[model samples]
Target: MNASPKPPALTTSRAAAVWSLIGLVLLTLNLRAAITGISPVLGELRDAFGLSGVGVSVLTTLPVLSLGLFASLAPVLARRLGTEVAIAGALVLITAGILLRVVPYAPALYAGTVLAGAGIAMGNVLTPAVIKRAFPRRVGSLTGVAMMLMAVSGAVAAGLAVPLDHAGGWRLALAVWAVPSLVAALVWGPLAIRGRRAAAEPTSRPDARGGTGRADGSLLRSPLAWCVTAFMGLASLMFYVLMSWLPEIMRDAGHAPATAGMMVSIMMFVGIPLGYLVPVLAARLRDQRVVVAGIGAVMAVGLGGLLVAPSAGWVWAVTLGIGIGSAFPLAYTLLSLRSPGPSVAARLSGMAQTGGYLLAGFGPLAAGVLHSATGGWDVSLGLLLALLVPEIAFGLLAARPTYIRLGPAPLVEAKEIVVPEPARAR
Candidate 1:
């Protein structure tokens, strides 16, 4: 008998992988782009829409809240519609939201923000899983790349906000970001189609790396999972809270609008380097507590400066940039580090981000309320300074070398954790 012809599936699989890789980077670039630029133009929005302090706060907080509200749906959509298709849907929402936000009506602005945020929420939860699935052995390095890209995009969006506002107005600045999402959505079109074909084959074995996308609730029992969730939540909360209010804080301290906007841009720019360093360094070390503690120390110094000498705003912005850059990527790495397989990673990623973002969503809102009530930023900054203590405690525990156990048995030691490779084409 003649040997069987080579399986066409292998060639098809490689093509899909390469395309999906491109799609992943494009998607990652948009994750923070929609959220970062708004602060720089908050004053304009307030004047345009007649937004009070509380309303401005609500505008900032709503995207994050939408992230929490819609994050849980990501895994479900991935499981049912296929991951690629689900991601495409997310990009569609983002594009729609960005376009809608630019409309002249105030309600359109609010609606668009929520829509864009929902897309970002799904991206946040699913990006880790896709990274896990595509490059299991290289999660740390790839995750660092993704975060670095995220930082770069965020920095550009913020840095250009004022200039763009000058060129065309806040509407043009906000509207331009939609182009990336629309392009990304179109790129994913082919991938989604391929995924649909693969999913249709009735006898398909569930990809051990979470291609099935089911995040069963088994994580609820693991204390380690909760620790990671809390760490991520608090870290994310600090990041969003500060990102939203820092420019305003600078303005309150008498910086020019352009200068104040640069503060947010500077913070994001600082993240560009740390975004790569943190995860790769965290992955190399057996324990990541030092890394977490070090990031916290940077945050403390930065926040302390902001609290005491709001006059020297630039120095603190760079310092906090160092803190925020490393802080978030390290927390994100935990989602991959703490789990055994891609599917488990996806589940944990989903769970952690949902709780984390919900907690973070409140930070901006609360800060706004306190600022509005007290007529100053002192109380807001003070609360953030106080919160760091618990944040550090949780970061240490979450950074320990332990794996989330999917079964009823106890948690596994660091050595027991396995980093399996993606299945090769036969």
Candidate 2:
């Protein structure tokens, strides 16, 4: 007749929390390094391998596709192998993929890129779940930390890849990332083993359920979930389009090639601090719709500025960078805030990322087609501006203080439904 007592929250020791944070930072560092590192060295690769434009495009596109395709598999992996083990396994895949590229063949290079991208995809989906489970109370701050690290590492790789390639050839440039991937795996290995051993133990509570709750496939039908997906997809689409063409846009505005490249660097640099600050601010707020709308406005203003005043590009770059940098972490934090528990967070994250990144893969190609068709940057940039309409609409919806309810509730009362312990801490 009485409801079952909810399980006490698992307590992580300060030392253990620090170590876990370290592992997370190290793992986040690898997520975008592989993709960005290759971009700066495409010339070297083309020269060495006699790659055509199509081949070069494939190399650039493979990782984005992998991010979407493999993200769907992360939840299945976490359900089966446990989250910690799945993450560790993903890191190992990344390490192997990075090392494989040093083999000096096109087959090996493409294979390594896909492998690495798949590994990064798993990491991308699971990292938010891990943050939700481990630091539920501090999701905003911690998500900011992780996202900042990811952005910084990516920028560093893009900057260093050319120098590293020059120093010891492209092989060394690609292979050097393997060291950090290996370190993250080693750091996370013990945690995964401990989780597996804990899970193997018999149930401490006789009536404890193994799952957080039944996922009624409601996420597939939920309007809120779609909004989240749209926000993620559109924001990513905008970011990637700019990443691919911002320098060219700058050059077209009468700036020299070197100045255009430097402006791109400035755009990225401006994001670093805003990436850390925005999520922390968003977390402290009750509803993030205002922040979300504000970001959209800033980005719109920046784009408008770019359209009107080509010489004041630095101002537009900084404004756009802050807008986009904040947008990503905002989307990530929404995954945790809008979910009741880590399991739902993982599912939502998987859904958002799979759909989001897939949409993102189209942005650059679409922009290119539009440019070629219209014979100018105006039409392509205008198309990007139009995308902001959907981005703002969905972002506002996703920012509301509401949890995603996927299906009908079980016969058990809400209080009687026990939230499952985190798999990582099991």
**Number of colliding residue pairs in each model:** 0, 1
Local error of candidate 1 at residue 104 (angstroms)? 3.1
Taken over the whole model, the C-alpha lDDT of each candidate is 0.85, 0.83
Candidate number with greatest lDDT: 1
Choose the strongest candidate by TM-score. 2
On residues 293-347, what C-alpha lDDT tens digit does candidate 2 reach at each position?
9999998998888878878888888888888888888898788777766777888
Runs in model 1 deviating more than 4 A are 1-13, 42-54, 202-214, 247-261, 308-312, 368-379, 416-426
Per residue, candidate 1 scores C-alpha lDDT tens digits across 1-426 of 989866798887787778878998999999988988787899999999998887886897787889888888887788888888888999999999999998888999999999999999888888888887776666777788888888888778977889999999999999999999999999988878977997798874554333443355578898888888998998998988888799899999988988998898788788898888787777766689999889889999999999899989999999998998888899999888877666677778888889999999888878989999999999999999999988899899989988776667536777733332322234
Q: Which 10 residues in a row give candidate 1 its minimum summed lDDT?
A: 416-425
